[model samples]
Target chain A: MTDPLLSVRNLRVTFATRQGEFQAVRGVGFDLGRERLGVVGESGSGKSMTGRAILGLVRPPGRVTADRMELEGQSILNLSERKMRRIRGSRISMVMQDPKFSLNPVMTIGDQIIEAYRLHAGGAKGQARQKALDMLAAVQIREPERVMAAYPHEMSGGMGQRIMIAMMLAPDPEILIADEPTSALDVSVRTEVLNILDRLVRDRGMGLIFISHDLNLVAQFCDRVLIMYAGRIVETLSARTLHEARHPYTQGLLNSLPRLDAPVDRLPVLPRQDSWRDGGPVGESLETDLPGGL
Target chain B: MLSLALTLLGLLLVTFIIGRVMPIDPVLKVVGDRASQAQYEAAYQAMGLDKPLVVQFFGYIGDVLTGNFGRSISTGQLVIDDIRHVFPATLELATLGTLIGVSIGVPLGVIAAARRGGIIDQVARVVALVGYSMPIFWLGLMGLLVFYGILGWVGGPGRQGIIFDGMVPSVTGLILVDSLIAGDWAAFRDAFSHIILPASLLGYFSLAYISRMTRSFMLEQLGAEYITTARVKGLSEGAVIWRHAFRNISIPLVTVIALSFGSLLEGSVLTEIIFSWPGLGQYITKSLLAGDMSAVLGGTIVVGVCFIALNLLSDLLYRVLDPRSK
Candidate 1:
């Protein structure tokens, strides 16, 4: 394609701990176009770290180093904090995993959303507030006015996530990173949040990085999927080919998931092999021998 | 709201009764060994001590309502007048001390939390530790020696600083107010200089508690998901910490500060003693030593009132800051 909107090359994030320098993301690299890309991995697999590194939000004691980290063809690694701030909400935005702790507990939903809009828009309070209301409506929130005035604690988890989505979209960022955005919501509300996000990404033609551990959901929604294990991306493939993933870790994860249509007497467990360490031949066979119940 | 008021009223009544019935006979203690049993009984009867405890409590409450706290046993001065003279000084000291505490403590706390584990944070932690560990009396003595003796930058003993050097004491209380009323700049400067040492000593104690509370509060807020969201939204580190994190953490800090304010008003007794600042703590100390029943009772009531009032204020502030309290 004509130069992806964002490109990350040889990205590594290391956290200094009592044990030693533990690498959380090892040589992870990806490019994002104006489409949905999903990074699926279990907790501590470094999917969240990758998102944070891209946004330059990694704090002290946790270091991020990349040979090439660029956004819209411009290198973002060396940008000054002031310049980085100008790009943060305007060009790139992130929605967190839980809305309960993500949203300011004391501030009204409307004030917070308007503040987010005005951070980049530099408009009057009235205009910013109007934009916030419009964003709430865009997120399919009914009675936007009432919801805007509500505090974070007053709203349900689903409603809070919707509000968070509205706020993130208010700045009209070119790229949006949603880290387990619907994981905290009920199963019934999960699809609703995902649909809202999907519709918004398509309408705006924005690049989206959806981070989750649910392969089925990612397969259905994302164009491309990256499977990660132990801070390393073991496989990259088109979502349509996720059922035929070639990485042992990805295959193991898929086998672990309960299947609805399968009528086997007992669910098959994927074989664990020591050679699967560091993505080797035993790992390679694990990906291919999936149907045989090996 | 009515229930809250009733609860407060009940607490005040209980405190008053306890103050009265505390085993030590106020009349005998005041009159001393010269008085006979009959004389002691007569004095106690006049003071309404022979009446039933409930009857005596109601009488005291009624007298308090009417602004009659009886005459001081030591000086025979009206208790109300003693309070009027001393309360202003105590309030001025408390206000200045709290201002110093909050202004210094909040910034120190925010910076320490922002840095997390740097040299500045380490230094702040050390200072907070020292402040908490040092007794008010010891700190007061050390402050006097350093600021007044070694430095010699301030006034000498019995001079009461640069203020009131030549100015007329128009108000007889509140040196700053009297100085201002007389339009005496030199007196004002002197009065302020005298105020600094005592205010700082008290402020240091308050600062210790407030900064510790604030640091923990900010640390919790910094780890919050919204802070991450703020950073992702392109806001600078300063904006995320100060604008978003600071506002969220203020409710708890405010409560700590209000409670500290109440403590300051009760007076940092040692600080007042060292500087000879005639505030309520010094008054109460002297009254207790001399067995001055009226003055002691009056001081207790005033201090009690201030403590209760500050708590109420903190509750109101809590509601204002977090609308979820509504």
Candidate 2:
């Protein structure tokens, strides 16, 4: 098989708190190819942290230490800010959780998209502008011209997210790291956004890291799934086989889902014992001594 | 725009009421204490103090509309004429002060905010603290002593040197412009020498205010998501800070700068006194003390109008800078 698009190993993110050094992401790692990979976890599970670490977007005081982190063939961990900037929006781009906070409110949508494109493409104003309008149309904005001239506040949540996708994709990055990109949108538009992502990846063969907490959505949308718990990945399986995941954490997560057909009196809760914390790699077995009752 | 108009109208009404509520009699202020009863009655009648309060208020408004602000009992000149002479000088000083303040303050603020917790930030914080806390009158005096008395580096006092008394024409009433127009470099130098120290002193006061506000504004913007987005867009750190963050922060800075300019025009009274610059602050203060009601009221109105205009200008700037406001 050809080399993966990106690889990470032994990644640890820790914050120095007053109490002590609190490790947020501990020894979590993965490899990504030109396929849709979803990272599913609850909030505080460090799934977003892993996504951010890939782009060096993790802010100070929250340290990222990794044994190995590479993109294509380059060691991204130590690249200078200048070199990293060129790679960021060009070779790899990100769509944040909410467009309300992600987009610059003062600027027009068209100008921002043009900026994203021209920063990497180095084209003239008219060309860049035309390209930006084309991107707006690709994102299925009905009135691309009016949307381009509009401000972020003037647009709806779904429209804003679409504009964000357009801007991030305008740079034509090889890998798109979407960090819960549609969690802020209404349920009605979620499928439309997913369709856009699906078409982009299928047509362009661009690799995707879809980070979200929605297990069912990840199962349906992504090619493979990584189920994380306590800042560690406990299971890695193809999306088709996610319902049959081996780890107790994954089993507990699946059990908690509200099934439309089988409505139980009380949803089964995970019998979270102390030993469950020490489960090593993906699909690793429980401790030798299981004094458990679930 | 409607808010601004309402604000100006409200200001005029408030100041008018304040003047009327004063316990001091306008007749006593105009006529001598030992003046005859008839003379006192004549002065009262001439002031229209004999009329009802509402009638007098409307009468005052009519006179104001017709450009009659009464006569300054002390100077014996029309109040409008005094404003025409003094307001231009005050405006020139304020404009210069604003220029100096903005030039020095904004860069310092950006540097301090960008390098937060570093040596530059520490030094700037201490310097800004001292500037804000230090009395302007004291700073003005010390500046005068060093720049004037000891060093003999600038003109001592007044608007221009006594030597340039009749050299430059007063076409614009602003000495610097008038001198340049008259093609008198000597007069220009004298005016520059006289103006620089006072302007810088006022500038120093404004700089402290403007820089402190700018620092907070920039600090907030630096943490905003757009700044990170700019950085992620392959823009350099300088571009992120100046072009992106600075633009976002400048909306609030406009208001601070404009308010400071208005106060400067109302007169850096202490600086004016130290430099003896004949601006509106000194004019109004002297008029009030001498009980030249016309001059005092007229000066008050002029300063009020200036504040309103500056506020309106800043509001428009905010709309232009942040399209979200529009």
Q: Which candidate leads the pack in TM-score? A: 2
Where does model 2 sit among the CAPRI classes? medium
Give candidate 1 regions above 4 Å deviation: A263-274, A280-294, B1-23, B29-32, B35-38, B156-172
The C-alpha RMSD in Å for every predicted model, in order, reads 4.4, 4.2
Q: On residues A111-214, what C-alpha lDDT tens digit does candidate 2 reach at each position?
A: 88898999899889999999999989988999998988998999998888888888988888999998998899999999998898789767888999999999
Please report the candidate that would top lDDT against the real structure.
2
- Residue pairs with colliding backbones in model 1 are A88-B234, A89-B233, A89-B234, A102-B226, B162-B190, B163-B190
DockQ of each: 0.72, 0.56
Please write out the lDDT profile of model 1 over residues A1-294, one tens digit for every residue.
Answer: 456789887789999999989999988777888989999988898999999888888877899899999997899985777888888889989999899999988888998898889889997998998999999999988999998888899988998999998999999999999999888899999999999999998999999999998888999999988887777777887788788876677788888878778755676676755554476321232233224332
Q: How many clashing residue pairs appear in each of the predictions shown? A: 6, 0
